[model samples]
Target: MANDPTHQFLVNKIVPIEIGGIDFSFTNASLFMVASAAVASGFLYLTTSQRGIIPSRMQSVSEMSYEFIASMLREGAGSSGMKFFPMVFSLFMFILTANLLGMMPYFFTVTSQIIVTFALALFVIGTVVLYGFYKHGFGFLKLFVPHGVPGALLPLVVTIEIISFLSRPISLSVRLFANMLAGHITLKVFAGFVASLGALGALGVGGAILPLIMTVALTGLEFLVAFLQAYVFAVLTCMYLNDAIHPGSH
Candidate 1:
């Protein structure tokens, strides 16, 4: 249906290619993911290309983004976390840009897909696990054991903590996926309302005014959500990295 809210998320294949048994087709989702990365990379590169004693507006924006991530890392994982700055920064930029781009009518929102968000979340958690084990050996198991638990309750507490730790990827992925999916679907529904109502001649246009107003309001709110979801993802990543760096701290 033309008014279906879910239609916007359909992943159409742009290039149908299969190698062996695997579908290696380039798709709308793939295109948007590439576009998101390119836009984020291009903006940062262009903004910071020229060395300036006094920063231009673009340079200032670039510098502020760098500082923002730097400060977030310092706070969340301490100075040692600086080692992962490049990865964290890239994730933040790509997610934020992808989110904002989806605000434009007809643009694909890759983050709205659970597969994409879940893959990103898995990457973050995988990094935490691999690095924690590599750096701490068996000591990384300390992350599951809180200090001062009674011997009787220790097994139960450990079980709960283990479950929570294992569920991190699902929670992280779902949070971003659900927010973007629901927000875009809601926006489309309200937009469809305006168009549908406005189609009924003079009387309907008047009714559309309320829905139109709501559509406009929701647009602004979605923009805020775009930035916030990116920040939340990055912050959680930093916290997970912190646990890896100091696994025995509780």
Candidate 2:
């Protein structure tokens, strides 16, 4: 099972519990998610605990992460969006830590699950909807109505816009889930090849070198993809929030 590319994604109950027909069991995915949250919180707390004139390494990393997310929100949604810094920063750190932790041997990748990713995406879009309506009321609907469209084609454009708006969560979730799933699968397949080839004979051991190299390269690439996907998720969330803040802007 360990050699199976898809086996790594299988969810197994660590502590099964049932309540009135609801199965609320703790699983590997849940464990990793809790771990990710803890790691992010601990890192931030430890790094920022001390005040320094010249920053320590941990302090520098903590400050850089803070500034990076701050700048992203400012650029995407403007200064007003800074109000969402806590949520956006937590989202970024959680996902980033989850991705990095999943790279470790025998660790579960929580974000690789569609349910987890979709939940996060839904939360993002939900925030946009809630804040948009709360702040702008019916004016938020103008977000679906692009400016300067001719009246003749307005209905069709509105329909297209509605579909696009509805699809945001699906696209956002699938992008992260698919990338992690595919990358891990590829890594596992190459790793399996290396193990299988090396177990054969001297000639097979020599052949294993190529797959081993590929696995190494793929691991590094996956690390980059992990961070990039997290950044892309954060940026998209900011853009969506921007639409809520200033509806109908081109």
Candidate 3:
């Protein structure tokens, strides 16, 4: 049981709570989410609390992350999209911090849950839908209609676009959840093998070396993937916001 690859994801309630006959217990997932927010807020706030003639290391990190996310949003959503900078930045930091925190030993991977990713994706799509209709009214429907499509194929293209638009949340949720789930499971399995093999004998220990090496390599790769997935999620969010802003353009 010590090597159970899926055991790491078990959600044991830390604070049992019940209200209106529904379980409202706080769990490890909730804990890690709060931790992620605390870590990110601390990184941004505490790092910049001290003003210096030369930026400190923490300050530089905060500044770099700020500029990176800012540039990414601007590029994806155009200048007008700057209005949503706070929302986008918050999402990017939360996701990036959650992912990086998951890389820590015994820390929960918040994004690994379908419910969490699905909720985030729905929030994004919901924002896009509401803002699009609010800002552009019925004109937002034009997002399903691409420009310069032949008249005969227009309906089919529109239907395809609509399906794609509806599928956004599903795709976004599955992408992140699947990646984290698979990566962590693979890492756990390999690590388990390293331990198992090392315990057998001289030959087994020699074989364990390969698994140990793989575990180390995978650990580094997972960290890279954690950052990349966060970036991808944020980038897609910005692109969706762009569609909301310019629904009739494409």
Candidate 4:
């Protein structure tokens, strides 16, 4: 099963419980999700627990992370969007930690699951819609109408805008899910080749070197992708929130 790439994503019940008719089994994915949150929280707490004129290395890292997300929010949505800093920071840290954790051998990549990613995307868009409507009342609907479009083309443009608005969650979720899934699968395939080639005679062992090198290189690339995908998710999230903050901007 270690050789099977898809087997890594399979969710197994760690503790099974049933309530009335619904199954509430604690799964590997659930465990990893909790672990991701815990790890992120712990890191932040430990790093910033002490304050000194000259910050410790960990403290520097923690502060940098805070400023990074804060700057992103300010740039994307302006000062008004800073109110959602906690939400945005937590999202970035959780996803970043989860992606990095999954790179470890035997660790299950939670973000690779479409359902998990979709739920996150849904929460983000749901927040935007609820907050937008609450803040702007019916004025939020103005988002679908561009400022300078010709009257004849306004209806078509509005229809396109509505469709695009509706597709945000789908696009956001699939982008993260697909990148993680593809990277991990490719790594597993190359790893399998290394194992298979190394098991044979001297000639096969010699041939294994190339696949082994490729696997190592791919692992490094996957690490880069892990960070990049998290950043992309966070930035796109900020853009969406910006729309909510200023509903009628072009």
Best by lDDT: 1
Task: Write down the RMSD of all candidates, one decimal each.
Answer: 0.7, 0.8, 0.9, 0.9
For model 3, residues 19-116, the per-residue Cα lDDT tens digits are: 99998899999999999999999889999998766999989999888898889989999999989888888888998899889888799999988999
- The candidates, ranked best first by lDDT, are 1, 2, 4, 3
RMSD of 3: 0.9
Error of 3 at 146 (Å): 0.6
lDDT of 1: 0.96
What candidate 1 gets wrong by more than 4 Å, as runs, is none
Compute the lDDT of residue 32 as modeled in candidate 1.
94
**Candidate 2 lDDT, tens digit per residue, 1-250?**
7699999999999999888999889999999999999998999899888878788999999999999999999999999999999989988999999999999988999999999999999999999999999999999999988999999999999999999999999999999999999999999999999999999999999999999999999999999999999999999999999998999786
Clashing pairs in 3: none
Instruction: Assess each prediction's global lDDT (C-alpha) against the native.
Output: 0.96, 0.95, 0.93, 0.94
Q: How close is every model to the real structure, measured as TM-score?
A: 0.98, 0.98, 0.98, 0.98
Candidate 4 overall lDDT versus native: 0.94
lDDT measured at residue 38 in model 1 versus the true structure, 0 to 100:
93
Error of 4 at 70 (Å): 0.4
The C-alpha stretches of model 2 lying farther than 4 A from their native spots are none
